[model samples]
Target: MKRIGIMVVAAFIGGAAAIGGYKLLEPKGGDALSFQEQQNVLFASNPKVASTGAVDFVEAAASVSPAVVHIKTSYTGNSSNQRGGSPFDMFEDFFGGGGRGMQRAPRAASGSGVILTPDGYIVTNNHVVDKADKIEVILSDRRKVSAKVIGKDPNTDLALIKVEATNLPVVKMGNSDNVQIGEWVLAVGFPLDLQTTVTAGIISAKARSIGILGRSQQQPTEEEYEEYQRTGKMPTNNSIESYIQTDAAINPGNSGGALVNANGELIGINAAIASQTGTNVGYGFAIPVNLAKKILDDFRKYGAVKRGYIGVTFAALDADEAEKLKIDDITGLYVTDVVPGSGAEAAGLRKGDIIKKVGGATIYDSPDLQEKIGRMSPGDKVQLTYLRDGQLKNTNVTLKGENSVASTLKPAVAKNTNKATIDKLGASFAPASAQLKTRYRVQNGVVVTGIEQGKLFDSWEIPKGVLITSINGKPVNSSKDVEDALPATRNGMTRISGVGPEGAFTFNIN
Candidate 1:
């Protein structure tokens, strides 16, 4: 059903492109075939050709069709099934909560992937196997095999996994940077459980963010949310503008699928879309093939995508903002804030520096800068030209991501406001695991696994991937211990602290 819905969307988005392909490619170079040749070609091309005739999509679709596949993943562990209730309660029971209780269950998950190499290298979304114990790929030929994780980048939501196989079908990638909006592209995938589904659309727009991050204060319009839909159909202005936006419909099962050009060359990975009603809204986003290649390189070399940072926050100035800033005829990223310790910081780059270009590519907005930098790893060096105090200046900055103290500032989303609720942090917590004892690694205090909407910790300022080192001045034994220690301070404020990428922070709650 999910796959089917995705397929329907692809058809709708591809409606015009498919029709266009039919009409434009239907005839061979406009050269009229001889009477006998016409009859032979007509019948041989399509079994049921309309009076107008039919375009042979076989060469286009078949050229890259077999390279697509489906992916399924499963995890091995009791935690998969355990509803991580209060660890304190579990502790009370575990010693003897009556050992006759329910046992933990196994966890299994599924997704899709595409073959990148004939040797069995498959690419898919990183979320598909971030923590899976076993990953399985089912090829177009219906052969299934276990795949090994090659590399993954969460920032880009892409993962590359490898299966030991021979003579595999591979999809050739095209230059996404060269693709233009309104260009024709096809989305090939197994949508809604349908095998080898194909849809079409034109690039609508490009480089759009869904505001999943709280960077911009402006609310995302329907068009703004199009990047996350993956319907393969969307509006203009939402795509990267660098995308080969098409009207072709895309859907859920179409994720990680192929978006190819007229030459049937893979250009982008069909990703998201825009829709208020959860269907195709004619808006979709795809990772540019060139950018994907860069991200893939990082994943293969570092096991994850590493984004280079310039430390300075930026925005492409519109005419209004440019006028307000007393600048004339400018289309470049306006610097907002230069992170104190980031790459931009060490280079003496200050806030409000208008970046004209990075490594020679014109940067018109933050997204452009992001895409450019994101395609690189920390410690990578690059040259930049910017306007500082109305003077055109040039400089270089080296990116860095492996922050030693980065684990100290991650936010923790929890219901407890008590500074001593370390025990409540339940879930996965790394860094500390290796730095601390094996017992302490698993016991790094708390890593809130799940949150209840109405729970007390729900109101607390908790962020994901946060590490609770210690609450108050005591050691944490279990979750309930923190709940019990939480001070009643809804009207009053309480102190809560944790660690993450930026270091450590302590704030008061209301």
Candidate 2:
């Protein structure tokens, strides 16, 4: 019985070894032994195995760690699902190989932020702090500080946050507009709680749109409402039509981070990625600095983007449309209409005019031209280049900045129609020509830019644009004359004197 048992054990052991051997030698759809084959995975999985390249990734990671930062944010409501999307959280598990609505509770989210200004103006994706209740910015140096929201533009999905500090290292703004496909670039941010993590790639394309922010959306909805709730102010959305496309392996926490050139200049603000499986598939987009500059200026001056308006809309021009329009070439923005009496109309610009440039910059399409014009304020004159009958004409047009260019911000002061006093007069005026000035250009008056659209100014014996030479017979040349001419109309209707678009004309008011 002992001999029989020993024989059975030896046979079992032999079968076990044979099965293991078969697994080791199993063919992975190939007849030859190859390093990359599945049969060789056991060896490949071992740490002692070498990489495909001569370089070491460990050294690169160590070098990038110091520059990365972790960002942690706490917000109201249930936010458990997003708890891991932050840069800090990202970098925390980044070495281990790691939004909503899908277990996806609204979890507190943490991610990375990049220190752009040494004095502590960190830039990160607007989504990271969109509705944060408490935002805590931690530096790669392990210092934590409370960050205040400075300005955020959602159309581009970038936000600028300020922390108290000085002598800080500010990343030089790079020209994302200048980046082209396949050009070397770098990505710096906190991913998975890891700090100063650096990744490298190349410019994959230009003006790439991934639709992550949605069309015509400037500020994220949640962020805008928060701004309103905190300060009783509303933010303006600046449409982002220009973006720098890169292949820098941008992941979730990479939003609002920096896309720098080899010179370490910030060319673009990393914005979005394209993935069928919810991760980077080698496609990403960033807002160009040119557009970001305007957003920043709007934030500084008006609390929101004071977008310039032309008051006319049109469809994008395709090659077929260009041919139908008899365009000489395809390198110009076709003007479909001139906003009646707006800046474009006042400059003799017509519906058929092809806008070739704004200021000194050549514009081949509406997106580029609109973005440039949108950045200007009213009263800021810009030169326009257009083609009229194969003849290029350059004309200068003054913009309107207030209602059109003033801040889009809601007035904090109550709308008090009740001023100290009420002064009503039946008079109107507008800018006078040099000849009219010769008669008298010293009146503090502005041309009746508006006549209540078909009221006293319309029925006036004078015509529209008829330089309101005077108001109530008061010597009127500029806007001041009309104001001075305003008579206390407590009694009956009043008559005013003015010049018509052709010659001297009269108008009446009450």
Candidate 3:
């Protein structure tokens, strides 16, 4: 019995020593079991966790969805339907078009808009409500109200419309100039006729010009001219697309919708999609809210876009061009020509000069400069920085009005001659002289003598002395013919053919 008790004691001693050794060899925190328990206790008491990199767009979506509205437009049938089969024919058929007689029901189309004010001032794409006989805004609560277009600026593709509603939801505008790449954003719109949809994406790029907006002094390619002839769809005229490009899913009905940041602030107006299928293909473009805001302000104050022009024609500087011009950096716009008696010329900006900055913002390309000047009004002074002969120079330029030169040069016309107006065509025309017709080899045409600063003529780069020979295949012998061919209330596309210094050319104006 003594020996057995001694053996049991020895065994207990050995087990205790083994346990103590294990404890001594364990990690600093604790034994495996105790470490896990400690972790559980810590977690329970603290409860803080690391982020998983997931974004929650619910707040943004909710906040912006209420301010976005569904815009439905109706178009009446008349000579505007000259192209018997129309693009909206299918839509009209689906929505029930006008009756079999001349008094047909108005064809309907739908898009989206953003409410800008509480008393019912709304902002939307020009294409959305352009030429519509009636526009109706359907709010988030499904209350439909008739709206009227107050003003439109085709250069920026923005329109201001008003409704008779009170206490409406308005979106908080954000500074798009501060929007960063890869930042989270939400596109709120009625895409594909679906009820308001909110899609999230990150900004893919900035200061993108897709050539959808025709460049100044840019001649259309053969393919573009043929495509317009075949489709009867005009390219965007005086279109400004210094767009904030994104990968968001923007479809047909997304036009004129709101592009909100993660804070639910409006940063852009969803406009065009770069898709071959006429649907979202991961690439979408929006007019920056800053540009849109400028347009809105001008519309409110001047009843039109009070645009400021520097009167310089330029092109993007390439490496070769930069080298040829002895420029070390190809970061500025290469000034090919400067208009005489204009702000640029007055400021001593000459051809071969490279504009480096305007109003302190770095000028990266033509669109950047265009956007900067476009946002300012006549008589506004801008600080200009340019590289002249490889030397950096600075000057201040006071801008002039669109018709400043015309007002100075042209002779006073009789009341009868002034009877004809160009309407929204944004150009002034006169009967071409015999010498101009002989020089251009055109028998009959009208001369585009002057243009508005930010209008169709300027956007199309229709320079003065160019002869407009035809419109929509109809011969234009005088200003009246041109005016008649392009009626003020006409809708859809227009084919404008003219001859310039570059020879015969055509423009498809929308």
Candidate 4:
């Protein structure tokens, strides 16, 4: 009986040990400490857990999603014959010429837009509804309405459209100038026909020029010009682009959509994307809201954009070019040529001068300068800081209107009586008669009696009967003034103003 009691006591001890092992090994809360207590104990022992936080886009998405809208455009496709030849002919050439041309259906495209006013004024990219025969806007609430284009500025790629609706959801405008690099941004648009998509990214860069505006002042090659003629989509020669670069996923349908900050304020208008597969490959660009605001204001006041021009051809300074120019830093544009009589020239900005700043804003490159000046109107006075001969200079320039020749200067008579022909200018000039000056109501000027073929004047389409009033903003009374006024450099650009057969004309010569 004592041996049996010892075995039973041993078995009882074994069962207790097994129960304790299971309690210790099993998950917390199974007769053991709670999970929270276990975590506290582990944390107390180690004291090193990651503390990363997540960015919640819910609030931003909620605020902006209602303001973003889907845009649908419809246009009649150009007939095959209108494209230079019928597609049936090409197919018949491969087979036999018995097939007739087939009629193409109307072309339809989709994009996105942002409401800018509570009264249903919308802003979008110009390319979105460039030639749309009909434009339809689908609001987030699924209300369909027809919209009409108010105004479009091709240079800035912005368009204003209006719908006959009231109390529309409008996006809050943010100061794009305050947007910082690496700041969180949200792109709200209808992408891939999906219900209002919101994409998150950071501002990768600012004041970026992607050459959507043609980079060179020279004439494009035959191929380039032909392609532009065929596609009708080449960047304008004087188009201004100061893009905000981001890594956001902006696809085709996202064009004209709102790019907002974390606070859900509109900062940019999604305009373009860099892609090889005809879709977003990460890189995207937006038009700065500040620039857009200027255009919008102009559109509201004027029937079209009243763009300001500085009248200077400039090149972006690089490290090597800076060293060559003896500049300490490559932070400003190097003025290659100041158009004669332009605001730049009037402000004493000489060729080879470095434009350091405009209106207190630092000029980093050509696009920066372009954006600053393009946003201003004619007759606006701007402060300019430039570097010339290693000395910094400041000047105030009164900008001129687009047609300054007819409005600004009085005609002057030639001092020299000799009638001379300028081979470089490709025109022969004679002093204007007093009767001719009286008829033209000019104080003094010269008349072009002859023009040579294959000359600048010929290329400008200036006929022999035109009067030469000024070259490069300088009043020219004689052929000598014309010859001396022409810059010695071949590649230099000049603006020649005179009265042609039609009216006062200004020609930009390179």
Candidate 5:
């Protein structure tokens, strides 16, 4: 009996020492495990119940709803003071309508967000907190905390925010590339000012671009409006809209919510709704998690998205477009023009090339290419498969920064030298005739004799027979004078002062 007791005591001591050693060497709870792994371990016993049917969303909804947060924002003035073009007419649903003009009393608005990290990293739509003065987030446990915007990308309509808290529930990020049509998904959010709501639907489509960012994006000041009025074009819109379409009943206040799979994995971020009445009409859109992952990571690393550009203006081709362009193929994007020093130009892409594939994925429309390129940054190499004169060819192009491309296109022309800079203007010029100068009452300038499509001058819509007085605030009697007067940049803007058919006008090209 004594020997047995001593053996039992020795065994207990060894067991205690083993446990203490593990406690010292094991990964610390917060730093060792990622948010997903932590959650997995926490719910190991109550594992995600796989859906047996397409409509079984009970497990998914329960898991996702806890991570979908309610975000309330306060704006100092009216929210609807600025407006432009929108391919999707769902802005009224995402942001409540208000009158334009003067500043109004402070107002409150609400939206949804998905917690991405236990330390309070959240993802939401940029429009939700675009101009908000203060933001408050309500968690599943009904606890309220203030959040600060970490970064915002108006181009993609996505924003990252964080709160001063820990142990927050997080939704696991899933592979959006594997999301299939007709697969059941859940839209979880706080919609129509209600509590956490979950609606089930199937994936309706993929790679949908609706052009909604222009409507809710920030507008330029009055001086900047001169370029828009002169050019008759919306200011350079770099908005990327490769959304995953769904039938999920996302309504007002659903912006920035979670669109999760039946397994409760986040596949997309609930963004827009297509409804004529500002309510659900069986059409909704979500930013694919595949794209959001890159964007959110960019937001975390840099304060803004480090977007890369292919530097080619293109139009998606259909049977009608192919027939119009006299092409045999009915699919692919028709490359209209390549930027002077862009990756497309460096890769030998010309005016009539057809872009069929990016990397290895086939390109059916703008979104397919835009979203893929949107995921990359400057200096990234992308393989392109295209057709030159009906012969398929491939090339690897190294993307360049926006500033590098802009600088490559010299914005001015000097005398008799190659005419390269003049060509860059996309317009032919002639010395202003004396009679023409007398009629227009301008001193010395050049006439816009001809304009080319898809060129800077054409984009400005400068008509033929227009007389110019000066460029960059210097008198220009010839192309050489215009060139000498132009500076590389004035605060990174090219200023053009000229008299057109409309009247004497001055505008800045940004």
Candidate 6:
């Protein structure tokens, strides 16, 4: 009887030990794991290993395709008036559209998205879901669900959306700052209205700005222009276009898809393709995931992008730009003007100062500065290195919210009068003739008689012969009129309204 009791006790103790071991060693529930940990766990369980010797993308493609979803969007009313579709869809007429002003039909568009969270958070392009009436998400397991836009930012061409589902596969977000040129990567999406497809390519470039986002937004109007002149407030487009350029075969339906590294980590959200034929033509652009993370978090928290501004107007300085601006320095950004009540003003950043660096990264071009600032929010502090009078100085600038008021940033205008103004314009002006006025449909104006190659007008691409109807809200029929209207406002911004080949337009020069 004593031997029997001892055996039973020993068995019970062994059973308890085994149960404890299982509880401690087993993987945690999906909800309890971080994205990186979850992704690591997933790949660990898979038997196939990605080959590193000869550029095999089998493992990455398989891991990413499941998280990349097919997104179909429906637009009500006229398709011409709506804004949902590929950015290249504007070129549809050049490709397949019968002609302009043809009978329009309601449009149904399809794109792609990457699942960022298991509970249905997804990241896509703003153009993919902007003004979409209904969004339907199709999962890899052949399950269909509805999705709604949480927030959409046209500046960065990014949108955060959510679906009403759980246990969805997610793509791990990777550090795009570490993505090197010529590195092999994969593009995963549903392209050409086909099933999930994967393509491989190399990173062609980084910090590329194609100016697509600016073209996609509504053009400035005369009223907005007039308001800017009257109030000394510049009309802000704030379009951020820093993209990771790749040679991946991204097509029309691939917008908002995943551009993943060899580790199957999400690095970019594929946005645009540089093709006039409305198809892939070797160049494809993706919004870097580094810039998208802040935007996505803002969407989840604030339901809008809380974009911060440095409160300065700057031009990326190259050899040609420096020559146009009549500056000696060929690198860094030349500060043209500073906005009043801006953080830049408080930080004592003046016009003529060249911004050399942001944080510690060198500012080689607009994208370098734009992308870094684009990732930060209002009230965030940033360190800037600038060159002033041949002296390099540093300052900490606390970014201001769009509506926050602070210091007064004086405009960068020459103390000298009209001669400096005309020189700054870099274009000779003449009184508009009756024929020119009639052609441009303007009441009174001056013509861009001639443009100096290395001047502001030429650099801005303001073509010769375009009618300049007004300057700083004053009707300019002659050069004398323009000279008198120069620097009219205390804020020191010059607003120009005119008719160009593209029709009525307005712009501000600081």
How do the predictions measure up, each by TM-score? Answer: 0.58, 0.56, 0.64, 0.63, 0.70, 0.72
Task: Estimate every model's Cα lDDT from 0 to 1.
Answer: 0.57, 0.54, 0.70, 0.69, 0.74, 0.75
lDDT of 1: 0.57
User: Candidate 3 on 9-87: residue-level lDDT in tens?
Assistant: 8767765564455345445423232212322332232222211233777867887899999999877766252222322
* Candidate 1 ranges beyond 4 A from true positions: 1-57, 74-109, 213-245, 319-330, 404-510
Candidate 3 lDDT (Cα, 0 to 1): 0.70
Model 2 C-alpha lDDT versus the unseen true structure: 0.54
lDDT (tens digit, per residue) of candidate 6 on 1-510: 999999888767664554444344435432344344444443333333232233768878887889999999887766665532333343342244323334443467788999986678888888788777899999999899999999998788788888988767778777899888888888999889999999989999999987666654435445543443344332346788788999989987888999988888788999887766678879889999989888887887778988888988778999999999888999999997676668998999999999999998999899999999998999999999999999999999999876563113102111112332377788767665432343344568875656778777888888755668988899987778888887684477778888764577787877
Say what the RMSD of model 1 is. 16.7
| lDDT against true structure, model 5 | 0.74
Q: Using alpha carbons, what is the TM-score of model 3?
A: 0.64
- Write candidate 4's Cα lDDT for 282-317 as tens digits: 778899987888787666556478776676656689
- TM-score, model 2 to reference: 0.56
C-alpha RMSD of each candidate structure in angstroms: 16.7, 20.4, 19.4, 19.6, 11.7, 11.5
lDDT of 1 by residue, 356-443 (tens): 8889888776667766776676778888888887788888988866341122112212223333423333232222222221212233
lDDT of 3 at 310: 72
Clashing pairs in 5: none
Q: Tell me the tens digit of each residue's lDDT in model 5 across 1-510.
A: 999999888767764564444345436433454334443444433334444254667877887889999999886555453232121124553433322222343477789999987678899998788778899999999999999998998788889998989767778777788888888889999888899999988999999987666433333334434442353222235678889999989987898999999889899998898765667889899999878877877776676887787777777999999999899888889987676677878888898899999998999998999889888889999999999976999999898876665454323211123333465567666565433343344557875556789887889877654656777777777767766766665886767777753467776766
- Backbone clashes for every candidate come to 71, 66, 1, 5, 0, 0
Q: What is the lDDT of residue 33 in candidate 4?
A: 36
Instruction: Write one digit per residue (lDDT tens) for candidate 2, span 1-510.
Output: 999999888767765564455356655522233212321332232222221232434443443344445667776566643433442232222223233212332346666665643346566666677667788877666788888887776555566677786544445454455666767777777544454557777777665544344322322244444444354333323355556777778766666666766655566766666654446667666677667666664554445655556533333466877888776566776776444446766788876777777788877565677657755766678898888888999988877543542132333111122222113433333343322222222232233433444445445433323334445556654454455556633356555554332334454555
**Worst lDDT window (10 residues) for model 4?**
83-92
RMSD after Cα superposition, model 2: 20.4
Predicted model with the maximum lDDT: 6
